[model samples]
Target: MYKNGLKRIIDFICSLCALIILSPVLIILIVFGTIFMGGNPFFTQPRPGKNEKIFNLVKFRTMDNRKNKNGELLPDEVRLNQYGRFLRNTSLDELPELINILKGDMAVIGPRPQLVRDMVFMTDEQRKRHTVRPGLSGLAQVNGRNVITWEDKLKWDLKYIENITFLGDVSLILQTIGKVFKRADINREGTASDIDFGVYLLGKGEVSREEYNRKQAEAKELLKRR
Candidate 1:
């Protein structure tokens, strides 16, 4: 109980301090993004927070609105400009989420908020991640991040939920700092976007019948390797 209390206090104080130090940087990003992206500097999307509650999570816009020859929006690669890629590599794009923390919509550390569509694949056990407010950094993120499989990320989330403590949160924060400095696991090679849970599931045949048999075979092989 004391640890939980301390964690919240740490979240409050740390987030407040960060907001002060990052304010100038945030302002510059907004102006630059507006000029380059031709819209608001920030991107807002509904994400699943604690208890599966939805909240408008914010991030600095790291891609432009560019479409393909068919008039459909282009792939993430096509939309990702050079400046956007740099911002992502430096993790400056996530700065706007500090506002979410200040608004009581998130914490500085916990399971990173996931998309609503991703929630559909979560089992009851996996849903335990929602017991605490989603955060900007989490165990999975500090670990392998984009390199880890969804199943591994789920395990780390559960571990974090069970072992949450002030010290643990601090440790995760420190680890996140190292990751940012090293630009580790920021994106998959040959891709400008992080792997989407929905797309991964569809590709793996988890949501479709035609590919179900093939995916099931692959899953069995994966299990055997494990």
Candidate 2:
């Protein structure tokens, strides 16, 4: 009952309330991000939602648009300024996603959305993560976030889909709160930060460099249309 209906009601109410309560913080971030990032305050992009449907995912812009001499964007680590790092570390950048939940494009608990381009690389089983609305926090996020491997993250996402319940969602929400407060598993080892899924797959030889580059270009083009 909750999975099919009541959960969405709860999500709508909670997200609405959160947006109201957090309006000040949101306003502050909007102003700060606009000043620091020198552009839009929000980062909006097309991400796959339930059943691979596409929607524009919104979040606070945490990185500056720094480009190199050739006009290519700088590396994430380079573009991510100190304030951006703080927003990421504290999960404050995610606050704007409450609007997504309110709009029915997301849930408070479910599988986190991945890049639309990344969808092409997912195995059939992994694609099951999109069976439900994408979430602000999910099983993979609570368990290991970006620190875990792609395989494990997909497994956790599928597990959540297979076993979603009102109590289960509540438990995951509480656990997510704990994880955020502790700021655990923010990054992987032997690196300055978490690696992108495409990079990870490339390292594992699952995707050729050419394919990854092509997919990246396609993603950029798609985002441009948005």
Candidate 3:
């Protein structure tokens, strides 16, 4: 009872206070993101929320609109300019998600939302992460962020979903504060700070025992190196 009721109270109070306190920073981010990205200050994308519901997740635009040969977009690292990189490194890009929390599309603390494409790839057990509303800062984000593999992040998300509580959320939120200050796991080596779920999926094989084995082996090696 306390878990359900207290959690909602915490969400309401904290979100309201945060929005008020951070309004100035939020406005600045909006203007900067818009000017940098050319039109849309906000980047909106469909992400799976609680119970697999689709919601528009919003973030500040942190990448420029520079494309490459054949008019296709260049890699994120290439397009991420200095200002964009600053927003990402400080996690200022996530400021727009306060609107999501206000609209009931997210919670202040829960498993971070996954893209719809990535959600489609979730295993049956992994899908349990969707049982609660997504969050701006989750267990996975605070623990490892881009430093951890997708599989490990998913496992952490699932574990958090299974053990969610008022105290757990508070603890996770506090820990996230520490991570932000420390700027841990901001990016992977040789890659941009942000991840494109679509591109990541395309590189993996979804079928055949041999394909599965190969992917698993590669994932293991990456994990060992990390």
In candidate 3 the C-alpha lDDT for residue 203 amounts to: 63
TM-score, prediction 1: 0.87
Clashing pairs in 2: none
User: In order, what lDDT does every prediction score?
Assistant: 0.82, 0.89, 0.79
Error in Å for residue 165 of model 1: 0.7
Candidate 2, residue 17: lDDT: 96
Residue 122, candidate 1: Cα error in Å is 1.3
Predicted candidate 2 versus true structure: per-residue lDDT over 170-222, tens digit per residue = 99999999999999887786654566778889999988999999978877776
Q: How do all models score by TM-score?
A: 0.87, 0.91, 0.84
lDDT string, candidate 3, 1-226, tens digits? 6456776666767778888999998988888777888878788877778887777899888888888778988877788988898988888888888888878888888888876656655678988888888988988998888888788888899888777777888898899989998888889777885454434555664455564455556544533443
Which residue pairs come into collision in candidate 3? none
Cα misplacement distance, residue 165 of candidate 3 (Å): 1.7
lDDT of 1: 0.82
